[model samples]
Target: MADKRLAIVHVAYGAVGQRQNRRSLSFYFEPRSFNSHTHGRDSANKEPWTTRYGAQQDLGYTGPLSFSHFPYTRCLEDPSQLFDIAIIGFPFDTTTSYRPGARFGPFAIRSGSRRQHARGYTLTWGTSPYDLGAGLHDCGDVPLSAYDNAKAIDQMEAAYTTLLSRPVLGGTNEAYKSQTAAISLDGKEHPRIVTLGGDHTIVIHFDAHLDTWPPSGTTGQERITHGTFFAVAAEENLMTNTSIHAGIRCKMAGIQDVEHDDAVGFQVISTDDIDDYGINNIVKKIRQRIGNSPVYLSLDIDVVDPALAPATGTPETGGWTTREVKRIIRGLSGLNFVGADIVEVAPAYDSADVTGIAAADIVHDFLTMLQLAEPPVPHKGPFSLEDLKYP
Candidate 1:
């Protein structure tokens, strides 16, 4: 005896008659025929969405799915939608020493961002980032060559560079387009980049190791890793020595590593300094050291105490709380922050998605800072420190 069950799924976009803020997709399933195969497979007692790719037989379900489903536009579909700032996911965690689950950081961060759509408006900054006139997009994650570390780093660098080359003003603030268009970096204009990290190794770390030095006597593959990406960034002139590192609590490779980091052009502030100087002084120090230079802020989740951010690769104890970090981040407004990243969130280790939620909000702060920053006026003469300060 042959027995089968048929299921029909209906997918609809927008509402019954409205189209303006169509954010939800409705799905209705109806079962009918009992003898036909769903998609070349038996239809008896098996889930229809079970195939090589884990996708259901094509019944066609295209609604709306994006970072937050608010102002959704892809880079390929409309490059003009990407401007001022763009979110790029670097889902590579191959160089992690203690934990390996940070590769899932991007997915967790995006998933956690679902809670942010309702309040994209920032009360602290007194503005909605979406309404600020800067072009924004969820350009999606960068596809990395999984096995090759060097190639993966190259891919990240190239992908970032490509996005940087795009024009920065085209959204509602088209009136200011001519003004901001004149904004240049080292004689070239570039869009700012906000990266969702895979691990602490990808940028800066919070634990007792600095991944800035080249592995001694290395060849092709050994030359690059997540920890070494910043070294490569220096080689490529992606950033300058005026860069700064915060929430440093880990031990270093050696005293020379300190010299190496100094040579690399970074001034680091340890977590203990917060106990001595407090957050306000820390903010002032960062602003003083990084004066006027374009900035790229890389925040490792481990920078927070393990109690607050346990889902990281190598967590050090006695770190700052989420509130403290957020305050510091907010205090960083008005700096020439061209790019930033929040990395090393391993959702598997999280208790109730706390780490992921914290990361998403951190990224939200980054966007807010970009919006609050004073738009660059056309440089009439040589750029000076006063030019970087914002109202």
Candidate 2:
């Protein structure tokens, strides 16, 4: 059977209903590699990138329109329009303890994402979700002032708050929660908004900002609930909780000491410890903790090997392999998340723009797959490691 184990695991979402039946003829396409952005053309046979982009004078095409300009709106940056998912930027680099230029993250991510979208590097391809009907928009960087990070976070928060309520191209409302009426403009809730960042500190403060929403948006506060942002979000009493910290290794007193507190309510599979403990098991732990809820993913480029993302601020060594990171992302599929972001890319450090491109590709693949996966899992009992099949 050609060693079915790897076969089944490698498929682009071939399994459904039961694991055994997924042994169909396909098992080698990650959602990204599925080639959605082929723009309805064949992947391998489509025009070559350079020639298609008109960079190659040798294999030139003298068409009136340029292939490079096909996606036309690559750098389209602005907000105020609605998207089921919107990309907001927080360009602050001061919080980084090491390198000092993550502020350029949004631009790089945008550029990368644009390139991938132009090519066939995404599965969800277009902006609207086929399974759930959500609209997505790349509403570039959130307006921020360099000197005031807190104020910047507030502005970022306000931007997301706006996105979470705006009507998307006149589609159905995609509001995640509105218990406290956290974000209401003109008396209507917007779509679910995702935020890209300038740095990791944005995550901590965003975690803080989520507290404004009511727990479960139904009744009295239990003091700790999923409405929060941290993995201990419930413990912290914020919205959209359950955090999995990938590509990070630090023992700062403030963050690590809480691990001793069983009630801390958040779980992090730090890349340092996860690599030491074995990635597969860590993947199992991540699957266990997040379950099948609406999660919001935050990826700092430093989480990958510096070689893979050398342009990020606070570059960490021994980060996850590109495949390892991709696996983590895939494992999170079939999940309903509010949004995702990749930050800490400083193109100034890398003229080649490798990190930015990878970040863009990763984000695009995730967002695209999010739009392609089966609808929100039936809120049944949590799935276990046993749910996996290896034959």
For all predicted structures, in order, the TM-scores are 0.71, 0.57
- Which whole-number lDDT from 0 to 100 does residue 200 have in model 1? 31
Give one digit per residue, the lDDT tens place, for model 1 in 110-215: 7777756556875555666667787777787888777877788778768876787776646665433432344453554456777887543112223333556654
How far is 146's C-alpha from truth in model 1 (Å)?
0.7
Residue-level lDDT tens digits of model 2 in 27-108: 3332444445555544544456775675643222222221112212211243445455555667776544456777777666
Q: Pick the candidate with the highest lDDT.
A: 1
Model 2 residue runs over 4 Å out of place are: 1-80, 121-134, 170-190, 201-236, 239-242, 251-263, 272-281, 374-391
Best by TM-score: 1
Among all windows of 10 consecutive residues in model 1, the one with the lowest summed lDDT is 21-30
